[model samples]
Target chain A: MNFFGIPDIYLVILGLLFLSIIMAIIRVIKGPTAPDRIVGLDTINTIVIVSMIIFGLAAGSVIYVDVAIVYAFLSFISTLFIAKYLEGGEF
Target chain B: MLNQLIDIVIYILLAIGVFFNILAGIGLLRFPDVYTRLHAGTKCTTFGSIFLCGSVILYGLRMWILGNVDGSIWVIHTGIALVAILLTNPTGAHALARAAHRSGVKPVGAVIDELENKPTKKSANKMEAKK
Candidate 1:
């Protein structure tokens, strides 16, 4: 089956990903401690990267997957820096 | 016939990946403490991304064999992305766990606190500064 010329399965998978993202967002908002929020943020980043790849495939474009690669590295760096800041020690 | 079989395999991979990704989200919400939540968030997503990216790579490979040059690019780049995810996810989780512990987010209901008694470098440094 297809919707608007895109395969329906792709749309279903994307919707599920969105649901997971929303769940992570809830955790970020409700988390009591700083680390809890950071964990939620990390989950969100990974999910977004996966969805970006799926979107790239569905759209028949290589650029999105390339962007996802760049995003993966940047997010990893950010997560590390945030952890360092929370540790309250010299970098 | 072979093309249809490949399509089926791709679908299965996508399904498995999405299920695990959703599980990660549920785990994040349900787990009580930061450590447990990180366990859920980091590991599940990493596993899920593996399958998800694997499916994409497989699709690209099929396309490349079918005379599409872009498929080769897709496969190579997706493989790199998967590697980046695999390398970085666990490292980031380790950092987050260490930071959480150092920042005093203790695990819930723990009997033995081995690391608690141990003097970390940060504390040793503080002692030096005070002298």
Candidate 2:
């Protein structure tokens, strides 16, 4: 009933994640300047978090979800720090 | 029959979640400005997470209805995670946008120089000139 018992479903989700990564690469390459790259990276990080959640569901381990939650906060911090750096001010 | 309905709901939620997530990624790639990109990136993923987590919760509830205890744990934990995302994601986007604007990234097609017009830097320069 569960396609390949979650693994296959996740394999398909991973394929989508791959597609997203390619699109992010395009933006990174074509972005006009630095902030654009930061924006792109931020977007990629969010997408990665979602994928991690899906992977957790596939594995039914819940640990992946825990990792996802931590990663979410870490990425938020990183994005803020990068943005502050971009703002050219003391943080 | 109710159990069948729950199963249907779970599958629908799964598709919806994955679809919106993909949309988020596409929007992130397609949008033209930093602000727009941030909007796409932040909002799409937020909506997607709701659906994805709901699917998991639905599955858990179905199991609980069928008498498994683990489903309740899954449901409760997913709820907490969703709450975390709801509280934090938009704030992060706001902070990033504010930082970008303060750093001098003008919105596309804007006709104002409000942030720069306070003359703080220029006034200091003028004082240096007068002295």
Candidate 3:
């Protein structure tokens, strides 16, 4: 009933998260504009952070949640940088 | 009995979070143009993350009340992560929206844009070049 020591409910939640990530990736692939793709990327980043937290809970570890925190900030910075680049302005 | 109640609450929170996330994904696919997609992608995910992280925090609190020291760490770190998400999600969305507008992506079916004639730094430069 346990896969990699994760309970069934947590596994289900993770699977659903994966599905949502796939959907976001689809948008990324099909988007016509750069900003659209960036939007999809942002969504994926947030979902990935949530999934990491769930995995941390399932595995009874704290490190994954900590990593998720770092990932969130890094992704936010990257999003802003990309936005600035799209704006085509200095810095 | 109390443990069961706590578990039920956690499951409810998780379900709510997952539902909103799925809705966000669907919205991203279904919405037209950049602004609407950004609307879907940003607000839904931020709301979902709140509930998801809330569940984890609740679970950690439950464990702590049961005398487990590790639960404190879980609660603290997850809370930090939640705060990080809360702080960054909207700011990033706003930046993206502004960038989209500045880069000339217009909203679908809009009759007028109020910011079009507004004098931003870039627009000022354009005006100077025209003169």
Candidate 4:
């Protein structure tokens, strides 16, 4: 439906989220250490989930909210894995 | 009139959520050390997510009250996601901080090394007992 159906407020929030993602990407690109990148990625993951919820509302779909939940689980697992790797622990 | 009030509340939540999230991004970029970056990156985003998701839940509840079936489902699922975020974010941040410390990514500026000494002392005591 684009902007025709949804309120302008959702659009503005989405724009801000996009900006947040961009800043996190900058950190991911230039982070000096591995943990820094991981931290940035984690931030991006959280913001992405929030945006997904907003997008679901704006676009009039419940599926996006479901997707956001699954994304949250997967990203949490990935963050744990990366942290373990950084810690030099086995498996 | 009630709907208008709800919209106003939603807008306020959105503004606060978006502001903190943007601040998080800035902190991630500007903070010097990994610990400092983690401090900024993890906590602010979690805080922002709470308000953002909360706003959505409120919207969903308002709609559900108006007799929309989809609104009920949205409220439940969004809630699940919010809980997931709350559970995962802090633990992940803790893990990250520990890993950073254990991997020898020292924080910028001078430090007392309290943690450093405690671990080494324990190890030494264990070794001496073994001997």
Candidate 5:
């Protein structure tokens, strides 16, 4: 149960993220509207952020969390830009 | 003894997080319309990620307590990442919903549109004629 005195907790969390990624792919393919696809992508971005943090813990790497932080901001900017494009294509 | 207790809690959190987060993705795919998809996508991911990060933080705290300095740093930093997810995911969803509306994407079977806020060409034509 405990590996190196740290429980194997991160493994379970990572598995969950993987399952979510699989399910979200379905939406990405089946989405009827453009914004629905955008929403799916945004949700995926959030999941990836959390999963990266879990990976960091399991792997004992602080760099993963730092990457997750930077990734979060990047995902936000991309989501906003996409929304703006979908809204009116003008201003 | 204490590590055992933490392990139990972590397992519980992991299970809950996985269930809901995966549900978020499934909902997005199975739902009939844009609004429903947005509802599933936004809520499930946020809720699931909360528990997922929480478990990681707990693991980190355990590592830090056991004198592994890097372990504690990992836990705290992961928490910060979770906070970032919480703040941005919803706002992005809102923006997407607004865009969907403006771009003419309707609900699956919406009976009434209470928010008809687009610029109608009738108003513009009337103004042009008056000018």
Candidate 6:
């Protein structure tokens, strides 16, 4: 028996996560400055990774978690690159 | 009775995680400046993700204890992913904050500008040339 008496628990969590993503997207689109957009994007990348994990649990597929792990590293790299670009640093 | 207790604890963790995530989203939209927005967006989501993944780890642990062989691997892998998140999230936020500051996104309604008063690389070079 599930805790909340719900058949599929992860699905509900996924819905909320999506709503959060939408809110973040609003910030990204309406952001007045470059750093604002960058912040939004960084937040989105994180939420996306979490959602990937939840989706893996929902689907009962182990591969999805693996994908999430890879995605996390890639996103981290991208964030660093974007930050470097923002700072006008060489290389 | 024991199983129900575990379930309740997991549910609580999940709820807390989701609530903080929602707050992060709202803060991103409502905060007035880039710095405040970053403050809200980064910390809350990182905190929320910890709980969310912790709940999953609990579930995996429960499954393993129930004698599912695959549960062990699942738990280990999920733990690895959680560790990755814990390691990466804060570093990214620090980088973003530094970049935002260096790129000249000032905090809103600020009084003093300490970093601004300090000489930048270019200005320092000019100072050296004049010496």
Candidate 3, residue A71: CA error in Å? Answer: 0.6
Error of 2 at A71 (Å): 1.2
lDDT of 4 by residue, B48-98 (tens): 999999999999999999998878998999999999999999999999998
Error of 1 at B44 (Å): 0.7
Please report, as a value between 0 and 1, the fraction of native contacts recovered by candidate 6: 0.76
Q: How does residue B48 of candidate 5 score in lDDT? A: 84
Question: lDDT tens digits, residues B1-131, model 3?
Answer: 99999999999999999999999999999999999998899899999999999999999999998999989999999999999999999999999999999998989988888987777788799889999
Ranked candidates, highest lDDT first: 1, 3, 4, 6, 5, 2
Across A1-91, the per-residue lDDT of candidate 3 in tens digits comes to 8688778999899999999999999999999999999999999999999999999998988999989999999999999999999999799
Query: If both were scored by TM-score, which would come out higher, candidate 1 or candidate 4?
Result: 1
Q: Which residue pairs in candidate 6 have backbone atoms (N, alpha carbon, C) closer than 3 angstroms, thus clashing? A: none
Model 6: how far residue B52 lies from native, Å = 0.6
Q: Which parts of model 5 have CA positions greater than 4 angstroms off? A: A1-13, B117-131
Off by over 4 Å in 2: A1-7, B111-131
lDDT (10s digit) by residue, model 2, range A1-91? 4665665555776687668767777787888878778777877777777677667777777777777778878888888788778766445
Lowest summed lDDT window (length 10), candidate 5 chain B: B117-126
DockQ per model, Cα: 0.92, 0.58, 0.92, 0.73, 0.69, 0.74
Lowest summed lDDT across 10 adjacent residues in model 5 chain A is found at: A3-12
Error of 4 at B104 (Å): 1.1
lDDT of each residue in B1-131, candidate 1, tens digit only: 99999999999999999999999999999988998998899889999999999999999999999998888998999999999999999999999999999999889987787888888897888899999
Going through the candidates in order, state the TM-score of chain A alone for each one.
0.93, 0.85, 0.96, 0.90, 0.86, 0.88
Query: Which structure is stronger by DockQ: 2 or 6?
Result: 6
Score candidate 2 by lDDT.
0.76
